[model samples]
Target: MADLTMARLHEAMTVLYAISLVFYFIDYLNKDAKAHRIAFWLVSIVWVMQSVFLGLYITETHRFPILSLFEGIYFYAWLLVTISILLHCLYRVDLPVFFLNVIGFIFISIHTFAPNQIAQSPVGDSLISELLIIHITFAILSYVAFSLSFVFSTLYLILYNVLKKKKWTKQWTRLPSLDQAQKGMSSALLTGIPFLLISLILGLQWGFASFDHFSIFDAKIIGSFISLLIYCLILFGYRKGKLHTTMYAWTQVYAFLIIIINFFLGSRLSSFHFWN
Candidate 1:
């Protein structure tokens, strides 16, 4: 019965994600305001179910899920979507937070139905080691938060470009004003930098603790550092008043791409990081 319940709960999470994706798509087309409102409500529902899914995963696994590229993409996607939604609500901007969620849904959807993928790792309700648990817990949360903020940076760039070319229309008109977008991105980066710093710090600490070697130079670390460098530049730009919205947004896309690279082909998936 417990097994069945977990399975059902997982299924519901997948369905909720599908609903979020659909709503995001409808919003993208600028089809109907009524539909957009409905989409908003659907996103709220998905958020709740998404939380439940995460709660169950943590309770069952007793650790963070930063294992594979698939998990990274999806986890980061959730973070990005939530931040986008928050910014959307706070600024009443037309940023496409929903579109990113749709993208994340498609990325994670494959695994949702793949029991083989989900079943490969089985923990028999035993307590996970304290060190491993702590390592994974802090790492995944910080990384996920940074990932979401990264997405916001990307959106800011897009809106900036449209504004740069002086191409405003009903399609893109709903985006935040340039001033708001600039400030919003700065705020996000400000928040993300601290998380990135923490992840890096914790990662270094883990390396020294586990391998007795300092400076692992693993793919994940290198990628993360590169992403960090870019983010630092973005911050510098902001301070120097050189960070325009489009550039900052592009920085986000670039960072996310690097994250994808690190997740799939980089060291973050190594046994050091663990990816099946």
Candidate 2:
């Protein structure tokens, strides 16, 4: 019964988010302040409801609700919403808010509605050391930041193409300028790479401490190293004026794809990181 109630709350939150997204779209298309205001209030209401649900979940479970993959995804979505709200209030970054909410809603909805693949081996307290917890947290955060960078980079590419063709659509006018998008992409990468490096370092430490035997050849570890190297090259290339802007953006896209694949498939290839 409690589970049913929580599921209902999750659905309600998703519905509210959908409505808010629609209002944001309307505002963006029509330049209507009323719609924008409505969207803001709706998001606030959804945030409040999600907070209540999270509180109830934590109280009932007696644990932070981010241990398992499913819970972590949901919590990440909540963090995005929180960040979006803060950006809205402090910076008035409505365009980023729109993109953030779209991604957040998709993730939260998936966690709420999809079958739980990690259920059989849910990340129990016994399996989670302090170092492991910190590693996972920072890794997830770094991925989130990288995902945002990819979004901005993709936008930059699209805008670049539109400008190259001398075609100015409403989207071109509504979207952030090319320079703004490039700056945003760079800022997100700069913020994320440090967290990724720290996560990798802590992950190695945790692996060494927890496992009776550890190997650097593990699929996840190898993928993480590759990801780090790719980003490092991107930074170096950009700084040295060796990488074209379009190439840099596409490289970020490719790197993010590698990240997604490794995150989802690495456990299947190695026992050390297996969830089930």
Candidate 3:
């Protein structure tokens, strides 16, 4: 019951943090003080919640939460929130605070989703150690970025079709302009690419280091690389004028489909990608 309660609390905190990120993004683009103020207060609430959790953890465990990988991740995230809050209040550095909270949110997500049970055997523990956890976190985060890209691209396509058809509605009017959608998609792809590349590198390294029977030709491995390639090519095509607005948006939609397939079917087909 306690664990379940804690889990719910953590989920709530994450949701608030995500909403804060949306406001921060708005402030980043528009320099809206109201949005910034909302983000600051939201983050401040998150920090207080995290601090309470940390206190409870220390009270129960009688030690600082740095001894285990899970505890270490939580503490790291807490430190990031702390720093972001200090920066927001003291230095007024909006960009750094936004980014710091992003990283913090990622780490908190890692801690939240990771399984709570420790393995009984040494091999079992080793298989699910820090390296594996970090690899999975990076991969998931990359997918998150790609999913954002897909959303914006999908929006772009919808807007293009509506405009092309000369159809105007109140709902359509609320949507950002085509150029803004294009920029959002491009920005998400730019963020996703580096994250996906790094994740692949780290995942491969973890696999090779941990598994004696690891195969580079694993389905997940192949699929991940293919997804990365397709995204990169789409970006290149757009930048080089080989792909126009509609075409580029279409490619992103198709590429995102590939990602969905790879994430699910490829996981089932892979030999040792056990974190499914």
Candidate 4:
């Protein structure tokens, strides 16, 4: 019964976030401070409710709530919202906050509606030690950051084309400037790469310690190295001015696709590292 109530609360939180997203969109389009203020308060309320839900789960389980795919998604969405709130409070970045929350709402909605995904049992701490848990957590966070970078990069490409054609839209106006978008993309990559590297190192250590027949040639392992190399190349190309802006952005998009494939397909096909 308590679990059901928590699930309902999470659903309600998603609904509230959706409502807040609409208000933020309106504020973005119409420059309405009142609407923006309302959206801010709505987000805060949802965050508070989510915190309580997470706290209850942690209190009951004596563990973090990110031991399952569903819980990881929920926690990722929570992190996005937390960042959104911080950006709003610190920088007053209204449109970015709106965009971030849009993504957050999508993630939370998936968690709310996907019963099969949520029904999967969480991996216990007994099965996976603390180092493995940390590795997985950081890896997931790095992927989330990379995902956001991809979004920003996509926006940058779209706006670049719009500018080249000398066409402007209201939506274009609401988006960050091309330079800002590029910076955002770069910043996310910079933040994610270190986490990804650390996670890889820790994951390797955990795998070797936990498995009797761990191999570096596993599908997931190879995919991780590929992803890391591709991102590094993209960053290098960007820094060296070897890749054009649009090209760099497109590279990020493709790299993100590879990440998606590796995460969903490669992980499943791997002989080891199949956490899902």
Against the true structure, whose TM-score is highest? 2
TM-score, each model? Answer: 0.75, 0.91, 0.60, 0.90
* Candidate 2 structure quality by residue, lDDT tens digits, 183-225: 9889988988999999999989988887788888988889888
Judged by whole-model lDDT over C-alpha atoms, candidate 1 comes out at: 0.62
Q: What's the residue-level lDDT of 165 in candidate 3?
A: 94
Q: Per-residue CA lDDT of candidate 1, range 1-276, in tens?
A: 986886677567768777756765667667567767777777666666666677777687666654444454456556555755785687555554664565556655664665555433322233234554454445555555445555556566677778788887777766656666556556666776776677677657656765655556666677777877877887797688776556666766676676567656664355555543
Worst 10 residues of 2 by lDDT: 116-125
Q: List residue ranges in candidate 4 displaced over 4 A.
A: 116-122, 169-171
Clashes of 3: 0
Residue-by-residue lDDT tens digits, candidate 3, 119-229 = 112323345556665666666667667765776787788888999999876545545578877887898799889988998998888878877887899898999999999
Worst 10 residues of 1 by lDDT: 119-128
Q: Which candidate leads the pack in lDDT?
A: 4
Residue 176 CA error for candidate 3 (Å)? 0.8
For residue 194, give model 2's deviation from the true position in Å. 1.1
- Of candidates 2 and 1, the better by lDDT: 2
Q: Please, what are the lDDT tens digits per residue for candidate 4 over residues 144-210?
A: 7887788788788888999999888665676778888899889998988888899899989988888
Which of the predicted structures, 1 or 4, would earn the higher TM-score when compared with the native? 4
Instruction: Give Cα-based local distance difference scores for all models.
Output: 0.62, 0.82, 0.78, 0.82
Give residue 246's error in model 3 in angstroms: 0.9
